[model samples]
Target: HGSNIEGMLEAVELADGNPLHLAHINAYCRGTVLPEAEETELALKALAANPNISCESYLSPLNGTSAEIIDGLPGSMVTRRCLKTGGFTEDEAGMEAALLSGWAQVNYPQGQEMTLLTGEAARDYWRGQQTLVSVSFAVNPVGPRVRLATAKKADGSFAVDAVSTDGGGIPRNVLLAAGLALVDLGGLSLQELVAKISYQPARLLGLANKGSLTAGRDADITIVDRLQHSAFATIIGGQVCYMDGKVLGRGGRIITTAAGADYVRSQGLEPLVVDLADSSLLQKAQKR
Candidate 1:
């Protein structure tokens, strides 16, 4: 969530070893203000030294976050930093002006995509729909993204951790396609790509049975055409929930840990406990 790896590491140290999932880390790995490649190398080195932390990066170049102004200030720290780094005004008035000038993009929830907003139109939109808007920053670079995607551990598992979309309804669902692209480009093997997208994330969430094709596991699967590099089918628990752009049925069920066992059972769902130590994040940290 932070751009400065040093700052993030300090925060982790201050937290006294709490498990942390650093989100969309590649967004922070490259930038204009800081030394670019050095930042990512330092971040990865720090990560290797501390296994208590894990991170995931989206494949896309644009980073998205809420555009809320907190007490006349930017809502997202990254947005603030990006604004300043890009030589734009970093204050509230500057942000408003930037939006109206079509320099910054606004993601309207109803519109479902990023678009330029400006002038009275921008102010009117913010006044009427502030709560329903997010801003996009073109801060992510491809070099760090590819390096992070392909980084591996001693056992050949991903070092940067998981493949994140940071995309659900916002529609940046390119994890599988982009990962496969990486594979095709020789940046990573197919198995490593799968681990980054599935196994590693499942391990992080402590969902031991959800990431792989092993017997007796959850049949959650995403069937993608290797040639097309796209997903045409998605199955959950042996049920074809989605295929060919059509929803078959609402087949999802709640999945939780032992700590939430009472709630899971109360909701008529089964509890699944995966040892936190089973995660490669912690496993690698222990080795350190």
Candidate 2:
């Protein structure tokens, strides 16, 4: 919700003790108020002091948003922010220029996997799709991403709650490959790495049965290639959903809070209800 470290801190103060979850904390620390790492430090400090707020960030340099243009400007606020950050106008003409110059990357369909397209091909794909595709821009820098993923508070608790892809609904999924890189670099231990990507997040969401490999816990697992640092297989609820480049699971149930169940059903999705009463936010509030 905040644009920079100063605004984010001000926003947290403005909430007046309400529970908050800051999504993609690294994306906002673009060296506006200070250097990127300095801004990140300020954010971590604020988060460490406040138990009411929880947050997550990713390692991808690319940020995802809608490619559509309505009237003259981009339709999504996030896309406009990215274009402005890249020194481009918020209008369709600027978007076209951005695509032509390879700054705006369109998610194009290849064989089985989605890949990035730039320059003329990207521009044409966007136009051909009637400007209704997802686009990405290299807006996130490196320093803040690294710091947020592994920073700890005075009590040794994680400053940020999880490592998330932001699910920009594009190809920004880099949690495993990138997080393993941190492990290899000694930024995190294998156990701590599992917690950030799994355990901590599961606790935040109140998924009591998921996250760990302990006895009586759900067997949701992601097998990874230690050398390549990519995912090899995925098991959900003790069911092997994916393995060896084949998708065995048919569809996914939507993970939603009580308030969102009606909408999930409206979208023809089966809802896997999770209670916010058990969520980390309310628990943190109780501690406070």
Candidate 3:
């Protein structure tokens, strides 16, 4: 029988002389706690010392264990259709949903409560509001593997505090203030956490020139104030491109390149020209 760590321990006892395989052991507390790891090591050593029992543990990268949703997958067509009917422009619906879904899966834990409302509820809550939604899927072969959660204000406004977790197996780096110095400190200081842990993981991944206080690198840095989730300033490529949370630079520079313009124009064999007659159209055209 398939089981988590505790269940596996019981199975070991019940199997008597039979062989057993510990599958996806990391899903349980055994992988997280020091004592559990020690216990597992001891148990394996004991099993190896015995002549009758054979045991083995399989380990896989946590990311690799989770399910993957491929582009143009059959199941995704439902979401695609829903978004189109929901008044989302094709590109906006597809790209935005993909991006949000990815972010949600990475941060939230599995088995959390999620509600997908429709008709009046969806209209009352989500209409004309900027929001972020997140989901968590379990990597374990155990029961009830996927879960979702959402946070919103009383007036149907989406709250910034809406974050999800995959059980407690959230990445250590993403916790930022809560993981490094807070938790016991009543609450986490976002500013301090950003200054510390958030960038280190990227550096460790051989993005050497990406995250640093040094010069001549990418100059990609974010500055934030206390108690605010938004960054005060963001610099890239030795230029202060974003300040006061607003992006500057446009027209074939940081925001776009001349090559990008050529490609877009080439797509339809049309010369892209801006018409200032309509304010809305002018703004959209400028972005392109």
- Say which candidate scores most in lDDT: 2
Summing lDDT over every window of 10 consecutive residues in candidate 2, give the lowest-scoring window: 164-173
- Which lDDT tens digits does candidate 3 get at residues 25-133? 3344233223444545444433443323322121211221121234433133323333343344334334245334432132332354333333333323332333222
RMSD (CA, angstroms), candidate 3 = 19.4
For 185-233, candidate 1 gives per-residue lDDT tens digits of 9998898888888888888776768789998998889888999898899
lDDT of each: 0.73, 0.85, 0.35
lDDT for 232 (candidate 3): 73
In angstroms, give how far residue 88 of model 3 lies from its true place: 31
- Measured with C-alpha atoms, the lDDT of residue 97 in candidate 1 is 70
The TM-score of predicted model 1 comes to 0.81
Per-residue lDDT tens digits for candidate 2, residues 1-288, read 547777789878976677888888887787766888888888888887777888888989898889999987899887887778778888999899889888899988788677899999999999999999998988788888899998988888888999987663567888888899999999999998898988878888888778888899878898999999987899988899999888898777888988999999999999988987787877878876
In angstroms, how far off is 120's CA in candidate 2?
1.5
Which regions of candidate 1 are displaced past 4 Å? 12-20, 101-103, 111-124, 153-157, 258-288
Candidate 2 Cα RMSD after full superposition onto the native fold (Å): 2.2
